[model samples]
Structures are given as structure tokens and as C-alpha cells.
Target: MSATAPTETQDLAPVRTESLAELLIATERPPRPSALSACLTFGWRAMLKIKHVPEQLFDVTAFPIMMVLMYTYLFGGALAGSPQEYIQYLLPGILVMSVVMITMYTGVSVNTDIEKGVFDRFRTLPIWRPSTMVGYLLGDALRYAIASVVILTVGLIMGFRPDGGLLGVVGGIAVLLVFSFAFSWIWTMFGLLLRTEKSVMGVSMMVIFPLTFLSDIFVKPETMPGWLQAFVNNNPITHVSSAVRALMDGTSPTTELMWTLGWVVLLVGVFGPVTMRLYNRK
Candidate 1:
């Protein structure tokens, strides 16, 4: 008789389920990272993206420089009687404007990550819920700092002197960074809600342009019509710009600073939770 084909049980070796379970459970799981640690880790990851793509710095560096040059030359004489004199007022405001404008990119970046499915992986990680969002703001804070330094350097070279000296400059920049960090949360919310990066950017520009241009960044609200002045004076950007300008000018910035800080608190308070909600749902 022909040899019987090997039985089905003989054809396949048995799987060692016990050994497989042992292999899987052999090592103890490490403790999860703390919230602060997780946030900083993700923040470092954001910085690494910049490191790999150095061109990302163009907005922080080149854009600020261009704003300094263009405004100082273009509006200096007409607005303040001379380029040098104009920069005395323009530099601080321009710094605020430039930094605030770039804040929108945080949203763009978040949207890009979402589109690339990076956020799906991020959500799976055992980290603090808000760490990723905070990380993006922290990374953008560095970008704000870079833009501040760049603008200040260009301003100084162009004869813009700060009466408040080094301390004042540092203080002003610190305030701007704080506000910018808070402001970025709004965009982060948009990033989660918007379907595309371009939509996020477009909406950001629409909001930012009116705010920057309408505020005291380029001119005194006093020069505008009463209706316009009312809006400008109440504008959050006006408060921030005035605070920064005062700090740089060695003048008391108490009222303006208080307003700026209040707005910062409001922005963070409102947008922070909304962004988290969207983030969790998305």
C-alpha cells in the first residue's frame, strides 16, 4: 500500500503558546513619562524638525529683517520725519507684529502632522493629554525669540536705541513670547478643526492682518477716526504693542502691561480647553 500521507497534525508543528506568552511578558514595562517630561520630549522633537529643515527659519529671520528694512525706509520719513526716528517707534511694534504673525505657523504645522498621520501615532503614545499641544507652542516660542533677536539687531544697526537698555529689551521680549505662546493656542484649535493646512493658514491671515494693521503697530490710534480709534484702542494687539513699546522706551508700562497680561490669560483660558477638546476628538 502507498504510504499514507502524513496526518494533518504531523504536517505542522504545534505552536508553543506558553513560550510565546513568556517571551511577551519577560520584561517589566517602564513607568510612563511625567507630563512635564513628555511635553519637553515632544518640544525637543519639534526643534529637531527645525534642525533637519533649516529653511523653516526663514520666516523668523528673513521676514523680520525685511519688515524692519521696508517699514523703516518706506514709512519712516512720512510718519516720523526720518528713518532713524521712525525706527525708534517702529521696531518694538514690528517685533510684536512679526512674532504674532508667525504664530499661525504652529497651526499649519499641526495640520500637516495630522494629514501625514503623525498625530494618529502621537495619540497612541502614553503621554500627558496636553503635552503635544504645549510642545508645539514651546517650539514656536523659540521661533518667537529668534525673530525678536533678529528684529532687535536690525533695529539697533539702523539707529533704533532703547532707553530702557538691555533689561528693558529682555523684558519686552519675554512678554511678547508669553503672549505669542498663548495666541498660538487659538491656531492650534483651528488646526484640529480645519480640514486642510491651507484653510488654517488662510483663516489665520484673515484674522491676523486686520488685528496687526488696525492696532497701534504702525501708527497711533489717535490719528485714526473716532470709530477706528475705538477699535484700535480696544484691540489686544494695541495693548501688546504699547506694552512692548513702553518697555523699550524706558517708560512705565503698567496699564498696557496689565491689559496685555489679561489678554494673555483670556486667550489661554478660552483656547486651551477648546484646542484640547478638538484634539481629543480628532
Candidate 2:
């Protein structure tokens, strides 16, 4: 009998089923988290990682100390006439260098995450795509802050002083953090474009070392050859170092600070898009 002629209610049951299916889908979908919240959550993840693996902090801790000592003693007498004199100039420059060098670790970490298929899990989640990178960028700022403190504390122990007072020191620290976050996009690009973490680390060092060492970090750029001096004068790191130096010394950092901030805009503007493109492709 049913085969012969199903009632209208029976015939429409499939439609009702389809409607409920759509309803289920509509209700089951979760709301997206705000971009800022997502970033902070991910930033928290990074901070927790530091807690579990305290050794992850070795670079920020040990490197800054080594650099402060090595540069202070190795070149102090010849360059600034004494370790004490050099520490003032050297500390600021080294603060910038320390933060810059540590930025590479972000790239390596990204690559490692990708290699392990961790990001595949991230993609399946409903969050802002850029948030992960932003999270890393923000979280690394904490690391940068740690490094800055390490450097400054070590410097103070070694008879270094910041004439800019606590305010200058605080201001310089803030700038270093902003600069580190901006510069990290370059390493993020490296992480995305490269296949392995080791390669990212290698390329990062190759680029970062020359920029840090060849600039006015440890000595006067005028002592460099004319050709070298020209490049050093234009180097973005040179501006960062100059700004940090001025800020820490209580001098007006307007000109150098402006230049350094400009570089921050440029780096983020250029690398930000490239990083996202490569990130999506990955």
C-alpha cells in the first residue's frame, strides 16, 4: 500500500530531513575568535613553551651575556680606551644586535612546526590565518624584552651605565621590541620559503651577522673605509644602533629614531605581504 501511494507527509520527509541537516550545520559552526584574542592566545602558547623547556631561552640568555663580555673586553681598550668607556656605547649597540639575532629563531621555529605537520592542524582550526605569525611576532617580543634585560643587567654589572636614566632605558627597551617584531617578518618569510629549519637558521645568520657586525655596533663608522663607511651609514641596523645609543645616553633620538622607525615600517610593509603569501602557499 505504501508503495502504491505514499502520503504527502511521507513524501515530504526527505525535505524535512534536508532542512534539519542545514539547520544542524548552521548551528554547529563555531564563532571565530577576534584577531587580537587569537594573537594573545598564541602568544601565551609561546610563553608556556618557555616555561616547559627553559632551555629554549638559552639563546636570549647566554648569547647576550657572551656578546656583552666578548665585545666589551675584546675591543674595549682599543676602541673606547677602556672596557668601562666601551660598555656604554657597546651595550646599546649590542642590545640591538642581540634582539636582531634572536629574531631568526622565530623562522626556525616556524619551519620546524611546518615540518612536523603541526600547521596542518592549525589550518583546520577557525582562526585568523595571520594570527599565528602575529602571535609569534608578539610572543617573541617577550623574548626580546628578556634579552634586553639580560644585556642591560649584565652591562650594569660590568660598570656600564645608561645616562638616559630609567626612562631612557625603558624607552630603548620599547623601541627594541617594536623593531624586533617588525624585523621578525623577514625570518618568517625565510621560514615559509625554505624547506627546513636548519636552512632558515643558516640563511638568517648569513644575513643578520653582516648587518649587525659591519654596522656601527662596536666602533665608529668613520674608521671604516670610505666605501664601507658609506654603506654603514645607510645600513638600517646603523640607524637602530644610533637610536638605541642616543636613547640610552639621554640624547635626543629624534633623527635616528625616525630613521629606525621608518625602517620598521619598510620592513613590515615589504616582508609582511611576502610572508603571508608564502605562508598561504605552505
Q: What would you estimate as the lDDT of candidate 2?
A: 0.90
Candidate 2 clash pair list: none
Q: Which stretches of candidate 2 lie over 4 Å from their true place?
A: 1-29
Off by over 4 Å in 1: 1-16
* TM-score of model 1 vs. true structure: 0.93
Global Cα RMSD, each model? 4.3, 7.2
lDDT of 1 by residue, 17-117 (tens): 99889888957899999999999988998999999999999999999999999989999999999998899999999999999999999999999999999
Pairs clashing within candidate 1: none
Clashes of each: 0, 0
Cα miss at 201, model 2 (Å)?
0.9
Range of the 10 consecutive residues with the lowest summed lDDT in candidate 1: 6-15
